[model samples]
Target: MAVAAAQELDELCYLSAQAMGSLTVSEHFHVIKLLGEGSYGKVMLAVHRKRGSPMALKFFPRESTTLASFLREYNLSLSYCTHPSLTRALGIFFSTPDYYVFAQQAGLYGDLYSVIVSEEGMEEERIQRVMAQLSGAVTHLHSLGFVHRDIKPENIFLCDSSCRWVKLGDFGLARAVGSTVRAVWYESPFCTPEVGPAKEAEKEWERRQEEGTEEEMEDTWITVEPGIDSWALGMLTYCLLTGCFPWEESTHDDRRYRKYEEWFEIERAHDKTDCYAIMEERYRENPPPSQFHGIGSLAMALFKELLNPEPKQRGSPEEILSYLGGPWLLGSEREQRRRAQEAQKEAQKVSETGGLKDELLREGKGER
Candidate 1:
């Protein structure tokens, strides 16, 4: 079994590199510290020896990276670097067995996931601004004929402690809009309702294998559509407001799945309640900062459009921006002042907290 497992591991795309502590790349940047690591690769905080500019250098292990995939990401980064809402990739360089992506350091408040989870939750105006940026970024990507298959809080980076600015990062899962590769390997709660592991199909495949009738897995061929990002944005909005995912898991077999089904359920029973109504009530009870004073109604209206079960009817990025107008979309002097105030508040909060077991907050500062 050990031998078989080792063989299976060897077949994976990632090639193991030597331990990376205190490593430097391209003879210019000196590694200061390790940021994070995952199945694909790890990120490091580095400084350019000559310019003294700090950067977050992402190292993708060559063993796991294909030439095509590498080029795809590199080109996409270059193409989207000009956008204010997308992280700027300075350049790409190859160092022995690994490829390095040098990008502008993102997030002073860390990723949205950490901020939302730590702060208990966010106010409505803040959420509207954040969502506007995110949805607008997605719209830009779609206009360029690419789909950001993975749109979640973790991929959304906050530029400062105030949460005024956000940039989308990590393009590894991105694909052309009409590409045949339509499946997500890992299930994310932020994914569209229809997007998830094809458990039933996988079980059938398992049965076929047991019966010695080999069949190709049809799971990867799930239809890809443009509304995927919009659906995910809706889920992200939900998390921002509630500090929790709408569903516990992205599978249909679970009871939590019924919560989503019940929302769009056509036949309403006596005991059933409209999900939108319940959400609106909850928002009123525990609301976020709102520019419009009574943003709950406006928010519910947008959520109704964004969270629509039908992909065709789901709100587009343009529609979202239209719904959240003035400072949220086009930006105004008032928006600038509000952000400055928020930033000041954030700094005060950090000082008050004084690093009391807040590793994530500390890390965010360190990363910046």
Candidate 2:
């Protein structure tokens, strides 16, 4: 019996050593499943051989110019993205000359895009929370002098089953406040106007070249404005609340530009404008389904402010927080009614005082 026990202990130690063997990009991680695949590369759900920890391993093609850009952003995140809403690249390994892998926390529920576009859309309160978190993350990035040019549903990963926690990932398109590059880093219909030429859409780039205007000196660097990210955030908010883009999907650059230009012209003609330009015209021409309505006035107001056609007119991340904090200037129906009542009472008091209160005004004038 003693010999049998000794033999069992020896076997257990050998197994333990095997499990704890040296970890490497190729050897340490075993790919359990492919999480996602995209143009850049593929993401795999992997397990650390020795630690047995679940990790999301993202692989990138090395030969592409995008690899360096992605690595730069990942390195930046590792240094400064400590916020809960931002996903961090925990570890990295060069599996081969042609491939790079990064280990990060795996999202159980997948990305926000899949969730919203799927049959189970999110609720209004949940949308607010998601926006709040996204706002916080963007604000943090701005404070650090960086802008996440790509702010879309696909990049937002739900960290919990409740959909309350999320982490913004994919910084390949992100850039510093002062730095500029000609390449568009992300592909989504939610990009801002200023981000037009330099987006993931090859059609836009091709159009610029065809127009004989895209040529630049090797060292030319356009100063980037962080406001573009804010605009994208607005687009993101609209998508989260409505589960669809505000405008019809346009694949060609000319088509997208025409829609924007027409809306801008209409906006310049009118004194009052909502979140989008030519909204009435769009509705009249192509009315969305009934399910698109009822996103609430407060949300719409915020969306309009964020999606302001003119980049300068759009609110900064800080300003957006203020709006959200005040619940969008007495945004609720009851709050609006209360505000109107206060205004009426103030007007009545002014009438009673008969405009500037005679004696006090005279005394002030005499002193002057």
Best by TM-score: 1
Stretches of model 2 off by over 4 angstroms after superposition: 1-26, 65-67, 117-121, 183-188, 195-222, 249-293, 323-368
Please report how far candidate 2 places residue 304 from its true position, in Å: 2.9
For candidate 1, the per-residue lDDT at 160 reads 81
Instruction: List TM-score per model, in order.
Output: 0.68, 0.65
lDDT of 2 by residue, 1-368 (tens): 32343244345434433433223565778888887777778888888888988888877786763544555654655555778899876745344566666677787678888778543346656676788888888888777777787788888888876679998988767766766567443345565566554443455456777889766423223456677887788777767655666554322354553554454454445444443334444545543334334444455446556666667777776555644533321134347568989999999998879765887789899999
Instruction: Quote the lDDT for 168 in model 1.
Output: 87
Residue lDDT tens for model 1, 132-192? 7887788887776666777888788888866689988887777666556655545556656
RMSD of every prediction: 17.3, 14.5
Indicate which candidate wins on lDDT. 2
Query: Which regions of candidate 1 fall more than 4 Å away from where they truly are?
Result: 1-26, 99-101, 208-216, 265-297, 325-368
The residue pairs found clashing in candidate 2 are 184-198, 275-304
